[model samples]
Target chain A: MSLTVPTSTTLVELQDVHLSFGSNEVLKGIDLKVNKGDAVSIIGPSGSGKSTILRCINGLLIPQSGKITVGRTRVDELKTETERIALRKRIGIVFQQFNLFPHLTVLENITIAPRKILGISEAEANRHARDLLEKVRLEQKANAYPGQLSGGQQQRVAIARALAMRPELVLFDEVTSALDPETVGEVLAVIRDLVREGMTSILVTHEMRFAEEISDTVVFTENGLIVEHGTPDEIFSKSTNPRINSFVNGLGGRATPLHDGEGI
Target chain B: MSIVLKQERAKQLPFGGIFAAVLGLTVIAWLFLNQSLGQVLLEWLPYLAKGFTMNVLISILAIAIGTLIGIVLGVMELAPFAVVRAPALVYVQIFRNAPHLVLIFAATYIFPFELVIFGNYVPFPDWVKAVVGLAIPASAHIAEITRGAIQSIPTAQWDAAQGLGFSRSQSLRWIILPQCIKRSLPPWMNLYASITMGTALASLVGVHELLHSANDASTAVQRTDFTVVVYLTVLIAFFLFCYPVSRFTQYLERRLASR
Candidate 1:
């Protein structure tokens, strides 16, 4: 598909966003940007606020203070649930738990949002859903309930369900974390294909090697702050920061030299 | 494993044993009565049957009305605003804890016997008042059941629906309530059985239900043995009606748990 906006255009920008739950601060003065069609990955340890950033970008969590601009809308200024819902409609998010509606068949899960919110005809919605089912390589499971599918298959259906909205950007929150080890690859492969198709994506994930392989930019966050961000090569292989080197080496189990232009 | 399965199956429905016990007691009572048992039963069966039908009708009407209002109250209990939620919580708490017989009495005396409709005085019958009386506790119990069922749903479902851009009302209508119905079914059936048994309480208010009919039969017969047989039949009648419902609820609970 052709790019709807110029590749240089910034699709999402967060300026010094800070959010807290009770007294527990999660995101502290964080700034991030995603250019149109760029696949950005945020990686961090548990409780590092990586997933919280994705939630904030999609208006699921509003920052206590700061500007979040997605396309033309100011997310922080969204005063009502109606405005938040409007913002959410344009952005799709896949949860770590793959929260497919257990009561719905896979096809119905994929088609419901388009038919209900977008006012698409049933036939058209089904047609689109079938196409998504094929893209996710689960065409035969369209009539099956989510309970009948494996974890990986359920996550794939969740992705299709999100894509059915034709969202401008999609957020993936550790989409493979809940999967059985053997099944995680299938979900990741589906996401890899989506990234290759030039979809603008922001992912919060723990799959270190996959992030290094797919991300246009890799962001490392620790204790509710972004510690470092750069191209995958810079963050993974060339960064001199002891913490970044330790995190990458510790998670990925790679022994690449910390200095630029140094061999393994 | 086979022994465990047998025990589980044995625990599920003891209908045959209950039936045998009722039959044996009735036969013992018949032997003691010294009159033709079949003849006495044949004469009183039609009247008892009419009263039993009234019991069934009341149960059906009460459950239908209670379910409708209870669902609304259940949803209200979860409303974001305290103004909408507080009254619903108060209603469920008061009615649910109150005695069923007391509610029946309250409904009997509190509501005016006549209702003015279009300037016409329409007499509200005693049985209809009994239905309203029984419905109060039924609605409160069902409201609690509905709330619990909705809460039992994983919050992930709500998040998914919201992330997909479905409004709160739309999510409840399309996604949440459909699941709630399945989860609520077994308890709802259990409530129905309770309400069916509670219909006997209506007898105190002159509703002419099964117990009332049995009371009249005993008084008119003027024999102690005949009274025992009459009241025993009333007990058997209620057991026969409600036992199956409880069994079916168990069946549903098992099916849902497996799924």
Candidate 2:
């Protein structure tokens, strides 16, 4: 349970993090670090605490006992709500449900936080939001309400909304899992482009091929602990751990190919 | 040919016109048959209208104050700590259960006329007392609506807002409250219309609103025969005012639902 002062290159570090929900222990002593501009993918079976890690990182859920650092901010040690909000301002997350405000038009959904929290001028916020919409290939749907758009389109808008803040780090919690099989490609394409643009991200994804293609570090969790941590190649083909091997085999994919099938 | 065109034609149809015509004819026939009653009605219309003005004023001020009180209390009811939530729950329960007329009486008679703050006496006007009385029950109803509407929003929205770096208050203001407004509007309008009708209770406390004005005018005329006309005018005035609120609430409900 030693605390490490994350070096300059490490943008996020979780040291000995422990969290529980009443009788259920969701995360038991998780330690992980992501270097700046690195794409880290956390892949695991359901109930293995992959999403819980992302929630703790985003301050949506606080750890029972641990140290979490993003850049210089000690997230768990933040004393005031304002301080936590300041810390959160530097981070963004896109959820599986594409939680866009249904009552607002897509443009408004993207512009709200920047205009309200950052006190950015309306014109400037709109300009930035439009640029993000362009990136997600959803500029055409900017004026449409979330309900009118297809699931993939809504998820794209959500990604755009997260990007509008210009966050230093982004977390994607199974961003494409809820989409129709055909639509999943478009949403994943958006995330792929963001990774190419060097957005530091921690993605909790079941898309095995996509994760292997983008992740600089791959973490495998089971029973509320990290059972395997390595580069994509090491974790996919080189790791000899029986648990990691069985989990990869359970996905119905050969570890060497990495793109054997859809998802676990 | 087009749906819009069909809807426009539907709007042009005089669906309610026949009913209105029949009702109007019946009232006119009654007036003509009782010529002296018709004359008294004409004489008392303006006096009753003046009292209706007082009702409108009381409703507006009381609703405004009540909504503010409701928003604060509702937020308190959602507070994470028991120290803050317990008192707010108690406040909501007490005010919501007490009858509007009872609150009006309590505010008018039992409450102090003046407060000594820092050794200075601040006098309370009778209108202010009546406003307080009307606001109590209205505030409680609004608080309940606010609490329910806010809770009804999916938890995912809260997580999304938090992920975007919003504090609890900022999330409530920018995200939660906007959605709550849509969900809460119809019931809120219902509460308002009822409160506006509740302004009649202010008459018992002697605030001289619509009913009080009608009572004074009827006494002056000294004819129990014209009593029907006096009370009927007051009833029609209220109907004219409240019917629109109900219609607007329906309109908004449909509009929001389409979203």
Candidate 3:
């Protein structure tokens, strides 16, 4: 399959971003850029601020200092929640916990954002949601509630819900981290399909081999700083930085065999 | 296994068993006193039924008004600004801790006896005042329940809603409050039962509810046996109304816990 031409247009840029929660500095002077149609992945140990960076991009957490540009809006400069909400409309984020609305059916969950925020008609939103559910291979589960679905199934619904907004960029924050080992592969496969479709994605993931397989650029962060960033081959195999070398090899040593089973 | 057995044993002797035991005791008391329970009920049942309806009407109105005000006050307590939260907090604290009888008395006196509507003097009934009084404390208790219910929802729900571009109010209306409704139902039903029982206090202010009517029946009959029978009837009426509510609340709690 031929991939779309990767555009040079920058979709998100963060310059010297620093964020702290009450004296504990999380993201210390971080800088990064993601171009349109590029799949960038951030790999690091827990508490290394990989998720924090994703939160900053979506305007969920405000940095103490930095310039965050998403599309044309300066995210750091948003003065009110309304402004931030407007910025967020163009960005979608999936969390490790899935966080699907338990009270709503799968179809309602996916259609709610477009119907409520975008003022799309219910019929149109439902139609669009059905399409997205088909894309996620969950068309059969549309009427099922989140509680009725498996964790992997719920995460795919979350992804479908995000896509219902037609966002320019999507952030996946360790989405497979909470899944059972047997179920992780199914969620990863759905994400792989999304990334392959030229969706601009920034993933904060712990899946070493999967990241290497899909990411155009792989960033390595430790202790609130991006230590190095380069092509997947460079970061996964060719890097000489001892920290990156040891971390990659250490994860590889404990890595389980990839389960390509589609059944969740 | 022991705990499960204990729970099963506990479930075996439910409200019905206790109610049957109480009825047996009442029958024994009636036999010893040589009083005819049927005659007493025949004479006063109609009058007591009228008063009981008053209690039900007041309870329905008070709960409706209280729930509306409570939802607003509860949401206010969670407001981002202290200016909005402070007054709601103070209101909840004041009414929640205040004596229900005192609030009933205050409502009776605070509101004028009559209202001038369109140049007409309209009588403001005591029952209306009682409803207003009962609603104050009921609203406060409900506000606390609402606040707790909202807080009990995991913060991840809020984060996910925000990331989807939902405004805080939109998230609360669409996502948070729907879930809160289930969490709040058991407690809210418990509150309604208490509020229904609290309607008896309206009798002190001459609202002519079930308790007030029982007192009137006892005074008219001028017999100790008649008084006992009428008062017992009043007690049974309240139990009949509130017992089912509490049982349903427990059922809802168990279902929620299972989920």
Candidate 4:
């Protein structure tokens, strides 16, 4: 499929991004540009630091060195916790664990960040929360506690909670990895529906077929680095990199069994 | 294997065992070995009853002060920077290391002349001084318990709240502290019960609590049996005040654990 950006301008740019957890580097001098209204799927193995990339954008983990700009805010330069927090409200993150506030009902979880941080009145926050819940087809479950819901339902609630903040950019850090195969489609469908409506998204995912369906670009990661980037056709169909060919084949890509030195 | 299992489950007995046993044995031993339960209960029923009210007033005041001080010191201990955490450790060490009775005695005798003097005068009653004395020492251990509870929550929670744009104080006020209070409630309630029972030691310094009232009445009656009876009444008073709060603590613990 031909790629199209869902946004009017570039929403995120990572230049020489380097991060470490005391001496173990997770992101090594990565550089990338994602225009606004774009849907990019980052695919990689379990420990490839795909999730770390999403976390760094919102200041959940600070990069030791380099520059990451999310719209107008510089990710590394936001020094105080307060400054980092102020920058986070503009970026919504959906987690793999579906981190809904288990102590609160679905509606309460969604409206909490908006009502507390943005100072939206209860009536106003309620209206927006209800609208987002409706979008995710979870309006009926508004009164339910997170523990009462199925994994798929919890994920949908998580999406509504993030959207209630009305973020300029949404990050999905392998959000469906923890779900059962039967439940994955429902969440993927919600995300696809959001993409259809022009929401800028950067998704860390392993679903190759799904990336082919909705992504404007497919980024392949390995050893804490972005190894390749192209349209799904170029990366999946006509790749010259032996590593890319081996990696895509291991994912059971297209069933042609492209032979190489690293055969499965 | 069975012995290992027994050891695993053994961390002192539950409310059904040692803790409750201490409460029960103290009452029964006070009654039968020393005096008749009903007769003793009736003897200082007035002074013991009035003293029971006074003891309760001190418990409420101590628990409130303990919890507030615990939160402040607990947060200071958990602060990310070393500047705040280092001094907090000294505070916890000093209080936890010292005997509560010694601190209470010192507060009553020394603090008036040292800290609260205006031209060498303290504008307070003895009872207020005693309450402050009990609360300060009790709070030191409370601060340590509170810090451990706060630390046990996943740092992801703090990160999540911050990612949602909450200020550090706001994140704590909204999320972290509520969970800590819920998590710490059982031990905290036990701590409150402990120091309220410790108030009997206040009688040694003249606080007029249940045991003190019993001492006064027994001396007035000139009977050791009367002292036994008064002490049993004090036991009853402690149980009456502590049971509801203990039950509430259990209810909250189960709810939080399930979450």
Candidate 5:
């Protein structure tokens, strides 16, 4: 009953990545490195392959030519689906649309993998799932279905669901884009909480303010290329890349600063 | 008021006459079953009941098998991955497009085909052939219903599970299938009832199911009216069997809607 607990560092590294879905190319020879502890935000316009990068990291979509590694395991070289699943156990993803299982209770949704794939006993998984629910301040919603919860509440549950896997790297795909303004802050708060734990997160998001406030590195993507890569200040204030500047400044390069002389 | 009533009357209930027609038919049917009291019960009852029960048996077995297989194929056909879904589509297309009669006959006679292919076969009982025949065709219809129900589930749901690191199979097992099964149940049960009624096809293969027994009794008694009573009994029995499931399905539908 002893699974070799992998104590490896060097989480995810993507080198010369290129992917094409028919005539449409998504990832174009992209190179990126995510270390053991890093909070990076990937920001870009629609159709600019921000999400595709996350998918490639998890092996949901394989790049045509890339040398990718996750943990001690090589990504492109994983021979079987079982291997990929085993690897993804270390990599958790929070979708843009919170996909808390509608049919299952919040607790059940969080603990399914622990119970099934990890071979953890149901009682143990439930105990752990309860803790995850508590982390999101949704302990009361442990038994409730996803339908009973609001969009923000559901997203929190999704975050809890991902953390239940206790992954080294968590990917957030525009976690607040689908939510109302009132709800956006709540979801962002949960991500901030994760940052407190030093959980490595790669967030594909449009919330420039949140990105600027929290991320260690912010990459501005345009037409399947990384136009600018730097700290939040570097990107917002001192970015030389015109495409990155225009994208961040919205209204075509009108830098709508968040506060007076406080553009972080 | 009269003009409004005239306009509303058209839409009030177009099928009101249907009740009257059914009542009239029932009276005629009762006369056939109720004629000669003890004699009617003695000669007609056993034979009609026996055939009716056999038909029920065949329908139950066939529908049960069809339902299980349909659920599996249905989930497969709805898979997002082309690798998993393509084979399922091929199976669905083959079965769904083939005539029900052809499937039934082929399943009934499949042992011989199995023998020809493998150069060996098990000696199947007559009941097995009839029941398998009915089930094979019924499954095709059931698979189509299951596929539709699975498809009606939102794509966001599948993606959500995918994002959770659930493999294609795991997502289906834990998330998609459960919802699909619940949604598919009402229509599935309805199909079950229909297949039960259709088990009369056993009579074609010289099986003494309900309809077969009824025909036998009609020929023996030299009374054509017994056939009416046999059919009436069948309709009532079916109504008895199916009404509760239909009600349950409706209740479930309403409950899901409220959610």
Candidate 6:
């Protein structure tokens, strides 16, 4: 399939990205560009390097050979940890585990980066954190530690924490996979709100319906390569690629293997 | 209802049994070893109490220096390069494996009594030597504790902190070390207790600490019959000082864990 470049200005771009762990290659010669205000969903079977792509974008896992650019920052070329940290401030990531600082309160968790990394005043950071908490509908839990919150509440707080940095790009790495079925909607609803607000984001998710509804672009990966990329409707319903077809057919909140008794 | 039931169960604990047992032991000891007890308590105990300050001073100095060294060694142990990690590993192994008494004797005998620093000759006492000896071993143990606590924190926290733009030091200071403090407290208390006990070894090198003072008082009193009373009083004094510290450590551990 031919890759179509979006008309809007590019916010993130990955060129011929390749990453491997020991002998197993996770991402191979992948190319993708995310334009500003666009929400892209990466969906695939378990080992399709879907999460690895998000991790690469966020600099959690550096690509061995690739050019990853976020805005004007060439993330792959960052030589120092100091430079990487400065680059990371422009990008936010929400993890599946909702890795909130359990030692800190909800307000502290959200306000910490702004105050510590950005060197903002405590009063200013707290004010911004309160606004983000109110946006996530969790203003009352400002003093509550992450341990006291439910899985969904914790994920929302994580999202709020990410947003409090005012990052130009946000990445969601299976944010709902660890939550209970009933709680997934709250986290997804927060993402949907982000899409509505035209925040640039890349989400690796298994929820096909949410992906279809919110994503401006849909990417289907199989065996470390993007096999299909297009508008959500075209890729979700009108895809002709056999691998993409099999993946969408198994889109009942799970990625079924294309061949019986064989893994992806 | 379950919370109320737990509170009630805690209230109904058999504290009276513990009180009775302690009282019974005290009475048995008093009856069996009663001769010259008043003399030991009134005369010698005050003299022994005089050395308590020295004991406290040694412990404070040793811990302050030891903890600082321990934290540095701990970070070094986790360093990515072998050049940085090797010396820390060697220091920990040598210090931790050596006996505290041997270490104290070696420090007192081997280290120079006076050193010139900044063009000034500073005299080093037996107490300073003893502290150095205790601190070396304590630093090794604390290094091991710090390393374990830092390693026990999940890698995901590190990744999350990095994703939020925190450098290695920033992640450690704000995210990793704060979490480690809860895990490290109990071991730190245990180390301090051992160090406090190790301070008793200072008496061997003529530091005149609590045990040394007790020995001198016992000899001056010249009461071989009151040996048990004098020694037991010293034991009680050490126990009273250390038990409260351990209990407070446990309390903090439980409280932090619940949080």
Q: Which candidate's lDDT is highest?
A: 3
Docking class of 6: medium
- Model 2, TM vs. native: 0.88
Give the DockQ (2 decimals) of all models.
0.63, 0.63, 0.69, 0.45, 0.41, 0.73
- Looking at candidate 4 chain A, the ten consecutive residues that score lowest on lDDT are A255-264
lDDT of each: 0.87, 0.85, 0.89, 0.78, 0.75, 0.85
Show where candidate 2 strays beyond 4 Å: A1-8, A241-246, A249-264, B1-25, B111-125
Instruction: Compute the lDDT for candidate 6.
Output: 0.85
Error of 5 at B15 (Å): 6.2
User: Model 1: per-residue lDDT, tens digit, B166-229?
Assistant: 9999889988998897788767987898899999999999999999999999888787867877
Candidate with the larger DockQ of 4 and 6:
6
lDDT of 4 by residue, B85-122 (tens): 89888988888787768877887787553345557655
DockQ-based CAPRI category assigned to the predicted complex of candidate 3? medium
Best of the two (2, 3) by lDDT: 3
lDDT (Cα, tens digit) per residue for candidate 2, span A57-141: 8777888999999999898898777887888889999999999998899999999999999999999999999899998898888
Q: What is candidate 3's lDDT per residue for B1-259, written digit by digit as tens?
A: 3356348547844756698569757955784666465666677889999999999999999999999999999999999999999999999999999988899999999999999999999999999999999899999999999999999999999999999999999999999998998788867987898889989999999999999999998888888877877787888888878766666766766655433
Give me the runs in candidate 5 sitting further than 4 Å from their true place: A1-10, A240-246, A251-264, B1-25, B28-39, B42-47, B72-124, B148-156, B220-227, B256-259
Interface RMSD of 4: 1.7
Superposed Cα deviation of residue B227, candidate 6 (Å) = 1.8
Model 1: docking quality category: medium
Q: Can you write out model 5's per-residue Cα lDDT over B1-259, one digit (the tens) per residue? A: 3355346445534443464458557756567667663356466776677677777777788888987887777777766689988887887777767765565667666655333336756566666777777676667777788888777889888676666567887877777778876677666876777777667666776778876776776677665555565566666656665656655765675566433
TM-score of 4: 0.86
lDDT at position A172, candidate 2 = 95
Chain B TM-score (each prediction, in order) = 0.89, 0.86, 0.88, 0.79, 0.76, 0.87
Report lDDT (Cα) of residue B187, candidate 6: 79
- Structural similarity to truth (TM-score) of each candidate: 0.91, 0.88, 0.93, 0.86, 0.81, 0.91
Off by over 4 Å in 3: A258-264, B1-13, B24-37, B251-259
Off by over 4 Å in 4: A1-8, A252-264, B1-43, B113-122, B255-258
